[model samples]
Target: MFQRALICTDFTDSMYRLAQFVPSLAGGGFKSLVFFHNVSVESGREIPREDPELLEKPRQRLQALLREVPSNIDVTIDVQMGRASESILRLAKQHQSDVIFLGTPTRTMLEEKLFGSTTARLAEKTGTPLMILRPQLVSTYTTAELELRCNHLFRYLLVPYDGSDGGKTLIKKIHHQVKTNPNSVLERVRLLWVIDENVRRELLGDNPMEQAQQELDKLQSELAALNLVVNTTIVEGSPIEEILKTAEMHDVGAIAACSRSIGGILKWSAPSLTREILRGSWHPVLFFPN
Candidate 1:
């Protein structure tokens, strides 16, 4: 669904490889692509004073990479010295990017807390949607696999819904995008509701199973009107476990989710389901900020 995408990479993330498949992404509806890279300054330096030769190396590398892109599609390469997240947001705004793509690596909990992921920080700051890809998985994809990934990135999506405010917002955003973009690759969607078994059994009284099914059915009908193949399922278990399992079983390209804002100090301390999914899932995740 994204026509103009701003892809942020560190080069180590292997996202630079996407330049080779620009034609395939164009086939999937992307008309413009901007590849962005930021070089971090020294810890104690207020401003970057690196050798001009050093800075020029990355710019030259990006130019070499862009040569593989097909001439028909619009492309831009940016190599700058700055904080990654800030530079990415600034470039996205300047370019009016429809979506931002980022590559995240698997991190231990300690590493996540100490290092503070750029993807997490960007998600908190930006209103734009993010397509989070796992670098380890993407870097290993064969040419054929990469082609498929580019051409069918959003062909099918698995949505985790629980009738919450975030869930409703996610549905509304999807509806709006589909209506506005007729050439979107989204052909099918699967809505999954996981009943948290840890909650008090009494809280789920009076046929909770049936009630969940009814909620999903209503959502299905609403999305089906957009000329999409919509399906719904309700499962009882841990929300994370069930959602991941359902995604694996369904063969979806990505998991579409909405992030709930956590304000105050809790924003820094509390764990988020959206972040958890983004960190844990090998599959791509389309995160819409609330």
Candidate 2:
């Protein structure tokens, strides 16, 4: 459900390879695409120097890739020298991009703690939605696989909801986008609520299962009004396991979620369900900042 996209990549991430299939991406309803890369300023220099030759290489490479895109679509390459996250946010605003595409590799906990993640940093600074793709998975896709990937990027979404504030925010954002974008690819959504079985059992008379079903039913009606087909299910199990399992069981393009809070670096370091999903999901994740 995105028209304009700003895709950032370090030459190594393989996400830049998307430039080779711009026409396939257009099939997903993206009208404009900007392939961006930021070259970090060299160390030991008081002022960063811009080397035209160094910049020209990537620029030319990107241009050659764009040649494969359909002529009817708008496409460009952006190569700059600066901090990666700052440059990305700046470009997204300049382009008025609807989504920012990023490739994240699997990282050990130690690596994330020490090196920090650019994706995590950008999420804190920008309001644009992020489409996080796993490099290991995407880099291996065949041409036919890539075409299917693009065509269904936003056709359907699997949302993990718990009737919490974060869940409400996620629902509101989806409603807003559906109302605003007539060409949105979001035709269907599946709402899942997983009850944590580890919690202390309560002796209260209230039936938790029935309560959860009622809540989901009410939400389904609200979302259905936007001309979206909404389906929901409630299950008792480990939150992460069930969420991931349900995502694969359904015909969803992405798992939509939001962070519980904006704790900056701490948020990235701490254990989070949303972060866990982002890291573990083989399916693409559409992440919204808290």
Compared with the true structure, model 2 gives a TM-score of 0.93
Displacement of the residue 157 alpha carbon in candidate 2, Å: 0.9
Residue 273, model 2: Cα distance from true site in angstroms: 1.0
lDDT of 1 by residue, 91-178 (tens): 9999999899999986656677788888878887888999989899889999899988988888899999988887888899888878
Residue-wise C-alpha lDDT for candidate 2, range 1-290, written one tens digit per residue: 78899999887887887887888788888899999988887545543788898888888887776646787789979999888887999999999998999998866667777887888888888888899988888889997887788778888999999878989999988888788887787889999998878766683226878888999999999999989999998998999999889988886889998876766434556767787887678888999886
- Estimated TM-score per prediction? 0.93, 0.93
Q: Supply candidate 1's per-residue lDDT for 29.
A: 84
Off by more than 4 A, model 2: 42-47, 203-205
lDDT of 2 at 242: 92
Best by lDDT: 2
lDDT of each: 0.84, 0.84
Clashes of 1: 0
